[model samples]
Target: MRIERLRATPVAVPYVHDEIWAFGRRRGQVSVLLEVETDEGVTGLGEAAAYPSADIVLAVLRSVEPLVLGEDPFAIERLMRRIELIGTWHHVKATSPAIAAVEMACWDIVGKVCGQPLVNLLGGRFRERVECFFYVARSDPAEVAREARRASESGFSTCYLKVGSDEPNTDIERVEALRDGAGPSARLRIDANEAWAPGTAVRMIRELARFDLELVEQPVSGRNLDELGYVRSRVEVPLLANEASWTRHEQLAVLKAGAADVLSVDNQMDGGLLNLKRSAGMCEAAGLPVVKHSLGELGVALAAAVHAIAATPNFTYANQAYGALLSDDITEGFGGGVAGYTDGHVDVPAEPGLGVTLDPDRVARYAELYRTEGAAFSFGDPDPVLRSPALPKF
Candidate 1:
């Protein structure tokens, strides 16, 4: 079927906790939902990771709409090549997310057309359900402890805590509280978000090693693989590369350099599901485990991740699904509304396509919010300084 129409709607969904990370505090989550309708009456849905700004993402999506309007939906490879050509010709990174959204929609259409779930199209299911880790955002130590306790009680086996703040001592305290409150059984992972230098990361990982952390993620800048290797060699805890390995080329570079013990992959950063799968295959070949990364995504993206993780064989670590962090979601119709973890695992929906449906009314409501209130921050803007002591430059 020929692609007929492409519609993109920007939505601003409130975060449940107003999470604070190394970069800044996020009061709300923003994304642009893309709907691709074919002439044969089949429609597909996807989400663009707009993050700090939805306007830019919308503009990019609109710019690429003409290239995809009359093409066949099933020609994903050819379409992606054209999208990449346009992106490279324009010298714009924003086009990546826009292309990813459209590519995902095409995959959704393919899955629905075949009467199979997205996972089935990706080489069948490897597991019945995908396990997700509880994400503890930056907060007071006491508050972190409380949330850790709640996560344990709620059947979560692992909790990922945000660290790498200005005060190293306070970050240590938060980890201690989380360790104590989460008990001995629950695993804890820390993400520095590239807020520390190699030396600082080494020192901090040495101090935090007493708590038995499952992994430490992106302690150093994404640009320095040598520094990452330095930190990884000194620390006992496994160091995971997040921002450093956004693309397949980066993934290979990190793997070749032996910079990290594990790699984190995400659909948004890798461009699309097929690209993520390819990255996972590379990691699998290198005998490294792949963990899924979350960018405080809504249901549309979360569903896509769930499907990808379910089909991926090397995805052993507890994946992050921040859908529970949202106050409301637009994908409520197909069981994508509120994020729920059952005994620390999220069930993969067996329904056709991406297994999530969008509610037009809710989309309209959030779209109105996007137009009126705009965004709280822009990805292009400088990261908000949360404390006084600046992070050490590499």
Candidate 2:
């Protein structure tokens, strides 16, 4: 059956507590909601978020729908390939975010068609739950330790600490305390958010190496690979690449350069499931592990990651996929589209097609928080070479 209609709605939700982290805040959940209607009368829903403007993301959704509209939703790989072909030529930065939403909806459609959960469709679950890595934002070392301890108590054996926010010494103390709080049993992972200089990254990783951190992520800047490689060579701790690797070529380059040990794939930034699988396959070939990086994803995206990870072989690591810790707004109560995390690990969702459904009443209330105020709007200029007629009628 062919896709008949597509829709995207961006929603924003306020942070209920200390929901803000180094990357952004829970100040709002700006998710791009999607609905894909098939000619056979099957409708599927999906959700994701964009760091870029909602208008731009919406435009991306609008642009890509036409290419796949009259195509078979069950022919996922072929549909993805078509979308990628169009994305490569058009310079659509939000292609992955848009594709992820659409791809998920397609998967949902397939699952409904087959009368199976997405996990069953993708393959089958290797494990009931995916291990989680708790996230501790920039804070006092003691506070960081406390949070780590709490996460450990909850069954999460891994904790991802946000560093490079302060001086090297202060960062050192926090790492030490984080390790201490995690008490050696829990793995300690640090993310710099591309906040350090190359020289400083080398120094910081070298100093923090004594704590035996599970990995130090993007210690140096993401823009400079030579510097990244240089820092990677000098650090004893495993250097995990998060923001640095994006497309296939970039991931291959990072691996060939001996820059990273772990591949942290963000489903949104790195395109959709198909691209993520491609990247994970590359990592598996290289004998490296893959983990999904969370960017404040809700139940739908999180569930997709779990299913993807379960399907892929050699994903030998836990991901920082704990969005529930950052927000209790998943009012569906941990099954019907609500993600649950304990001790930094999440039990795999058993629902068909992400199994989580948003509470319409809550969604209506929260969507009001989405503001276009101060948004630097960009009516994207279509690529000169590959412009197609707008399918959604703009």
CA lDDT, every prediction?
0.82, 0.70
In candidate 2, list every pair of residues with a backbone clash.
Answer: 13-29, 129-348, 132-344, 132-345, 154-343, 155-343, 156-343, 156-344, 336-356, 337-356
For model 2, state the Cα shift of residue 253 in Å. Answer: 1.1
Name the runs in model 1 displaced over 4 angstroms. 86-95, 333-339, 377-394
Residue-by-residue lDDT tens digits, candidate 1, 128-202? 899988877647999899888878887889998888776799899999999998999889999998999888899
Query: Mind giving the per-residue lDDT tens digits that candidate 2 earns over 1-394?
Result: 8988897767665433344333333343556778788999988877666556566668878778778788888998888778778656225433457777888889888877877778777668877767767666546888888877877776777788877543567778888898888887777888877877778788778888888888888776666778788987787888888777765557888888878888777667766776777888898889898777766666667777877787777677777664534454433655221136654456666667766676777666655556542231111223411444221111
lDDT for model 1 comes to: 0.82
Candidate 2 shows a clash count of 10
Task: Give per-residue lDDT, candidate 1, residue 302.
Answer: 78
Q: Give residue 234's lDDT in candidate 1 (0 to 100).
A: 90
> Ten residues in a row with the worst lDDT in model 2?
373-382
